[model samples]
Target: MKKKKISLGDWIFNIFLGLFFTLFTLICIYPFYYLIINTISANDISANGQIMFLPKGIHFQNYIDVFKIPDLASAALVSLGRTVLGTIGAVLGAAYLGFMFTQQKMWARKFWYRFTIITMYFNAGLIPWYITMRNLHLTNNFLAYILPAIVQPFNIILVKTYMESISPALQEAAEIDGASVMKVFMKIMLPLAKPIMATIAIFAAVGQWNSFQDTLILMTKPALYTLQFLLYQYINQASSLAAMIKNGTVISTSSLATMQTPTSIRMTVSVVVILPILLVYPFFQKYFVKGIMIGSVKG
Candidate 1:
């Protein structure tokens, strides 16, 4: 086949589209880049807004100081623990319920499915929610994070739709053999539903990793503090310390390179908290769009 020549209008349109997207991409990326450069630059220079577009007075000491902060390791562990455990629980629960809902013989299936989906549209109010958590004795409990997220209705819907698009013959064949329901789910549906499951897992993991509101309302123990909540505390403390150092009321024990300021603390903590999710995201990104599209095909 001969190549078609591009028209002037088409070329102009393509150029405009490319420029628009480039500007949009830069807009999205620049804020994170700004935060990183600010954190790595000298406190005085960064405070003066001298560093932009590129870092000045490059140093890794802000990260070092952030690592040295009290309970940071523990808080990170809490965040990681909740994210991993909660994501696993959510994926499994949603997968099982989604598969079950697709079964024609399931008792009161429509009612239960409708009941679950109703939650997405309604809230019982914050006070009632807090009281419910307290009543369940989940306050200051790690289960608070895992249990509540395990049965997310939206995840179940996605998984259900995705599974519905799979060949029912595969499931029926398994049932015709000596395979049990659990075995069929494990050996057949679950493996086939990997894409959508990965999508749900990513959703659950990000939500779990970023969540701090539950920690604020449900936790009283420092030991259970999440990385995000601790970052909030660090920002407040760093502000006070920055003010004190400025007024000459406190002397710096660390060198100029490792000094902590509110801006540095805030940006460093944000990077620390955000980096893991960012790193994990690309691995699941391949399945993400495919999963959402296939899962939305039914309804």
Candidate 2:
């Protein structure tokens, strides 16, 4: 076989493409990297904006001091609890409802699907929503986080669109084999829909993990406080919190350079709050791309 030689234009375009993407990748990555380096760098250096592009005087004391705040552990536990439970509920609800909408045998399928989607575009405003949640006794309750977000209309639509792309012959074949709808859905639809499910799981998990407004409005108990909400409070009170930490912790001469500061506290908390999502994203990225691309094309 003969190899084809590249044209001058092709060679230049390839070079341009490589450089463009390299720059774009750095643009996306550098902010998080900036946060990381600053958080771990010496407090005085970070505060003075002297640490850029690389860290100086690296230390883990920022993380240690941030973790020392009262109720941080419990708040983190609550956030983790909501993220796991809410993601599961959201994925299952979206999958089941999406699958059901595809079935002609479902009672008033078109009407119900339309009704569900309508809620996506229309809202009764904040006061009514707050009143509604209050009526349901969700205030200051842990279930406040999970129950309200279980059935997201946009996620359902994505799931339905993805499932519709699957050949109906598969479902028909399962039915012909005397498989009940539940059995088919559990054993067949779910397995085949792993990509979309993974996509939805990532979306739900990020949403649940980063949620702050819900906590602000629905929860009043310290026991129910989420990590993001706590971070929010910390950011608003960064100076006082930093002062408190600095004053409370004994500052030995050796540790003075790495001691806490308002800027360091903010950056450290941001990193701590976002690191889990960053770590979890790579595992689901392949499925997320496949799911979103296919769903968009199918829709």
Q: Pick by TM-score: which candidate is best?
A: 2
Alpha carbon lDDT at 217, candidate 2: 94
lDDT of 1: 0.89
Error of 1 at 106 (Å): 0.6
Candidate 2's TM-score: 0.90
Worst lDDT run of 10 residues, candidate 2, spans: 248-257
Clashing pairs in 1: none
Q: How many backbone clashes does candidate 2 have?
A: 0
| lDDT string, candidate 2, 190-299, tens digits | 99999999999999999999999999998989999999998888777767756766676645666556867789878998899899999999999999999988777754
**TM-score for each predicted model, relative to the true structure:** 0.88, 0.90
lDDT of 2 at 235: 77
Per-residue alpha-carbon lDDT of model 1 for 1-299, expressed as tens digits?
99999999999999999999999999999998999999998876777778889888789898887788799889999999999999999999999999999998899999999999999999899999999999999998999999999999999999999988999899788888888888989999998898999999999999999999999889999999998998877778986878777888756544544577777888888898888998999999989888988998884
Give the residue spans of candidate 1 off by over 4 A: 1-23, 245-258
RMSD of each: 2.8, 3.0
